[model samples]
Every structure is written in C-alpha cells, then in structure tokens.
Target: MNVPGDGGKYAWRTEIRTRRLAVPREEREREAEALAEGVAALNAHKWVCAYMPVGAEPGSIAMLDALRAVGARVLLPITAAAGPLLWAEYTDRDSLQRARFGLLEPTGATLPAAAIGWAELVLVPAMAVDRRGVRLGRGAGYYDRTLTAAREDARLVAVVRDEELVERLPEEPHDQRMGWAMTPFGGLRRLGGTEAEESSSAG
Candidate 1:
C-alpha cells in the first residue's frame, strides 16, 4: 500500500539522510554484512541491474557477485552521449571503468534500451528512500529516467543501510519510490510501512 502523506514527511526523510552521513563506522559495517547475506539468497532470476558501489551507500558489489555466481546475467550503467543514463550488458570486470562520477560502468559493447526489460531485478542506489517506490536520489534523476523502461513486474529494489530508509521522504510527481528497502540490520522493509518504525529504524 502506498503511504499517504501530510506535513513533516520531507523533514523526516532529510533527517534520515543526515544520520547516515553521520552513522558510526562500525554500525555501517554490520549493516553491510546483513545486506550481503540477504542478497545471496535471492538466486531466482536470469538478469539483474545493480550498482557497483562508490561511497557510503550499501555497495552493490556483493549483489553483483551473487547474481553472477548464480549464473544470472547482469547489467550496469553506461554513460551515453544521448542521455544522462544508459544500460550495457555486464561482460567482464576488465571491461569496466570508472566514470566521471565515482560509479563504475561497463565499457564493453553497449546494449540497447530494448534489451533492458530482460532483467528480472534492478538493484538501485539511493541516498534515501520511502516505501512508495519513489527514491530520493542524489538529485541526478539517473535511475528515474532509465527505470521507466524496466519490466513492470521486475523488482526495483534500493539497497541501503537501515538508516537510509526513512518514514516519509520528499516526493515529486517525477520521482519513483522503490518496492522495498533492503537494509543492513533490519532485513526487508516494505516501503512506507509505519512512521514510527521507519523513523526509529532509519533514525
């Protein structure tokens, strides 16, 4: 169910993001361990789109490995001249390179957007998120643009530390909330579950 909003939601979301930037290093590591374990069990898909990690976000490296270890096809982002985002098949680590942003992307042969729907899962990156599947990104709108073409039933999951999933996040018409928040300590949190929980868990 989509969580209804009133006032103070945006404020809460902002606070959650701030908290993560300030979370103790030890706590962050524990969260990472939980996330890696959970991802290892989701071995029921053929294709996946996941992050390659940059900074404090729950790094997608673990998820990428699980996907590949299960022989699932994986895809990563590619910077194209035509747009702010693009998709390419994951070939090999040697073919990947660091982009202008700290993100690592595929540099092998580019894949058409038409080939995007082939994936059954999309593990996204976000600064913070709410349950409505509308993610609060780094203000880039990169996933917002490309995810529009993802398969309707394909899971759009944002892996974050428990502190990154907020009770109520700022939402605009163009933003997309993820289906679930995969946090480190808390397991799977269905977005917008309850304010008290979202706040305290992420807080």
Candidate 2:
C-alpha cells in the first residue's frame, strides 16, 4: 500500500521512532487536553464520529465523554469499501471490536455513510498531518471516502499529536484533509484540506 512518506519509508520510520521516543505521558496529556477542548467545541451541537485511540495516538476519550455528557449520540467507525469508511451509533466502549489492520473498532450495526450528512462534526484519526490539513494516514484512505459523504457543514477535525501538524504533505485527489487538528496542547488551527476541497480536485 502506497502512503505519504517524508521521502522514503526509512524517513517515515525515523520520524515515527523520534515521535515515540520523545512523547512522554506529560506531553501526551497536554496535547490530549488541548485537542479535547477544540474537538468538543466544534462537536457541541451534533452527532460526532469518534475513534478508538491506537498506539501513540491521541485519545478522544475526553472529548467523546464530554459530548456524551451533553446527551449527544456519538458514533464510531465500521469498515466499509476500500479507501472509505462507514459508521454506527455507539453509546459506550463496550461495542468495540479488535479488527483488521489492528484498529479498534465498534461492532454495532452500520449506519449509512450518508448518515454523516446529518452530522455536525466528525473527528478523524491520523498518523501524521500538516497545517495545510493534509493527513498521512495508514494508507487505506478510509476517512477520505467517508468525508466524501459528510454533510457540507460538518466540521471535520483530525486528532493528532502537536508535532504531526507540520508544514505540508503529499496528497492525492481522493485524500481527505481535515479543517482542524485537535492536538494535545497546541489547541486548534484551521487546517488546509476541507470537505469541499476534498470533494473538489485539490485533495
């Protein structure tokens, strides 16, 4: 599977190693808090898609819990067609499953990808991303396909570590860029790729 790499697979490996080496619990917590606030703010009004945190990934537990506290119906991703994703309503963590690609997923019945049309917000996962909103995911491009079906007004935020929000990235026309990068401490910034742009040819 081809993916966006700094230059080569080795470079990406190096970057991942560095990120893992330097990320202490303190830094991770700070980034998670900042991300939670930004994510919660954008998701305050509607249904939101949340993902289970993977290795070294920032947790949406805080933000998701907050949304739940406010009586919002939270949703989780269920695999769909290649390079795309689907979702299902989930009220808690109990419905999750350990799945393909080592991703933790929710096993509930699937809702239409079009269901996102009613969503006010969606939080995505990323291995790395850019200030321009270009995300370097695990190469499946699942969110890319899902974003294609999301509501035009839906706020798409990608949860990542602060350092992953860098200068730029490689993007394909089908790739999805988020509007915000909810980091652990750096808060939020208007990112580059948008639902419109992704829908356009600019992705």
Candidate 2 off by > 4 Å: 1-14, 81-83, 193-203
TM-score versus the correct structure, for each prediction? 0.78, 0.78
Question: Per-residue lDDT for 8-104 in model 2, tens only?
Answer: 4356545754665678988777766766665555535657777767767777467667677776788877775464567787776676678866676
* Count of clashing pairs, candidate 2: 6
Candidate 1 clash pair list: 131-191, 131-192, 133-176, 133-177, 133-178, 134-176, 134-177, 135-176
Task: Please give the RMSD of candidate 1 to the true structure.
Answer: 5.6
lDDT of the candidates, in the order given: 0.69, 0.69
lDDT of 1 by residue, 28-49 (tens): 6777666766666664688887
Clashing pairs for model 2 are 30-184, 31-184, 31-185, 32-184, 132-192, 133-192
Model 1 worst lDDT run, 10 consecutive residues: 194-203
